[model samples]
Target: MTAEEYQEDILDHMEHMEAETMPDVNSIDIQTEIQWFMRPYLLDFLVEAHAAFQLLPETLFLAVNLLDRYCSRRVVYKRHYQLVGCAALLIAAKYGDRKERVPTVRELKSMCCSLYDDEMFTQMEWHVLQTLNWVIGHPTVDSFLQIALSEVTYDAEVEHMAWYISEIALFHKEFVSVRPSVLARSALALARCVLSRSQARQSEWAGTYDPVVVLNLSNHLYQPSQVLSRKYASMHLSAVSTTVEEFLQRQAQIARRNITPPTPPALENQKPDADGYLTPSTPQKSHYDAVMQHGCLTPPITPDNEFGASNFAKNVLPRLYPVTPTSAPQEAPQQQPQQYSYQPYLQPRLAQ
Candidate 1:
């Protein structure tokens, strides 16, 4: 058989391998500290590292696949979370990338701000390989995308747009269970529509994937990684992210235009004068002027309120330009504790 035929046969076989080895759809269910939302932050780290090392696109997806598979089996602590990622990248680089391009453990260590020592990374790498049973030949979404792109007329924009959409899906937990082939096809269709390319070719493509399912999956692309968007904003990628953003913005404007404006109530009295000009009734004070006069609309200030004139004179002014010779310098106010949307990064771990 020819090389293309061999490659196609391998990919066809990978569909089965993916089903057997893919991480659990609700894999984070087993994780105690790692919530679903925090996955994006970790993904952002991986993207930056992937770009910095100049690794192949397939290597990045393979690394994430390994990381998720490893996490699926292991109990990863928060401190060791990023260490797992470093190990996954290292293993993926060794597996897929050339020997010269593979990142050294020291390079990954430095990328991680030296939080993990050389021995720790080595241990983690060995641990990940053992957990995965050395099954690292999983076909990623990018592999499927290549085949789809090849089947149709080639456009650099479509390739970049489809890849950008697929990368965004990596941050989403919902798409984890969906097959990469499905994602690749849906992303290509959406990219074509965004670029206003012909859908004549897609008529054949739709028969394979359900239109409802493809439409639903397409909705998830609305949210993408900001870091990845900026990465694709370069001239090299044809700035497809900006194109998608403009498409969404134009859709929003069209939706706004369709909204019916509220109608004014009909007048009861006949009020037109000699010149036939129906003059508006009485002039009213501008709401903005009223606001300026009233200040910020706080409750009528009592003597104790900080912003009250008397209190400002007595306390605020002195603090602003303190003339105190030495009045036992006032204690600074304690700030309220900040509330974070997600768990904070690793606190210093004690040496074992």
Candidate 2:
């Protein structure tokens, strides 16, 4: 979503919360109001960048979740939103991309339209790292949905439809403003509905947990009502999904309307190739040269066994379904717990 759309969505949500609960709108604003309103702005800013880069949807989704979960638990004052947003995106880049290079603080600032200075962005990044206790892994919507979908052996058509609906659901800011659990359930329901229609005659659909039940559960998360799954499915399922050909058509429309096409970073002086891979005027030195000559980087790891190959393939292949990596990097070894360090700048304010 664009920044304007995000701002309008949040304002509508605040208004709704105001009317329902009749909270004092003037005193500190809404009940959940933060003195630091910049956090949501930063989040919307990051979302626009991520969407522009054609980054993993899971990357944007998980990053936002981490930011929300962290902020919901702590208090951050002025200029802190930048820190949380950057840290969340960094964590997301790591988890979502096996070979994802760590973008420098400068690069992050550029991503945010240069709205933040390097020093301010760095401090905020540090604060987020500290707030998260420097741990990045968390259970995520992508994993959850993937796991749920894998339970049934649906056809290619079903798979395509399910993915289409899931993507469309994200564009609805009303859905995004709701609780994470509600959003998850809604995505699942949409996915299930698509799959069911594609395989209406199959016994697989019959044996699976009722799609209506899943959807009704989702609706209840938003408001109390027994929403009819068929009615919901009939109204939205076709509008949201289709076979592979139709899905691409929808993606093109989304790119034109709601999302910007993938573009090269600000540092890349030249336009990227057709596939959106950045190529500088002069190619950079290879990893081995950098490592051996300058002692700048680490060497690649060799897989030890077939079991390792199986594990890596299983973990990596499924995530590739909707988001394509810009460049393949050797998977970084998971960081050891002993080596974890939170940045000093993000340390919580000590009591006087």
After superposition, the stretches of candidate 1 with alpha carbons farther than 4 Å from their true spots are 1-8, 200-207, 210-213, 261-352
lDDT of 2 by residue, 1-352 (tens): 6654564464355335323322122332332535433444564566555644556657866676666656655664445566667867877776776455545677777776777788876576666667666655554445444544554574444443443444333333333334333334445555545344432233432233445434543343232111212212332334332232353456568769776657766774543343343334665443222233333233333464322466577674322122444787788899867877786777688999
**After superposition, which runs of candidate 2 have C-alpha atoms over 4 Å from their true positions?**
1-44, 77-83, 154-186, 192-352
* Cα distance off (Å), candidate 2, residue 251: 21
lDDT, residue 289, model 1: 16
Residue 57 displacement in candidate 1 (angstroms): 1.1
What clash count goes with each model?
Answer: 0, 2
The lDDT of each candidate is 0.77, 0.49
lDDT of 1 by residue, 1-352 (tens): 6766686576668678878778885665779887777789999999999988888888888888888888788888888988998889889889889898899988988898989889999999999988888888887888877876666678899889888887887888877777777777777777778899865353453225446545765686577788898888988889998998899889888888889676899988644443343334656332121122323322334565454788765665323322436667788999999986987789898999
TM-score of each prediction: 0.71, 0.42
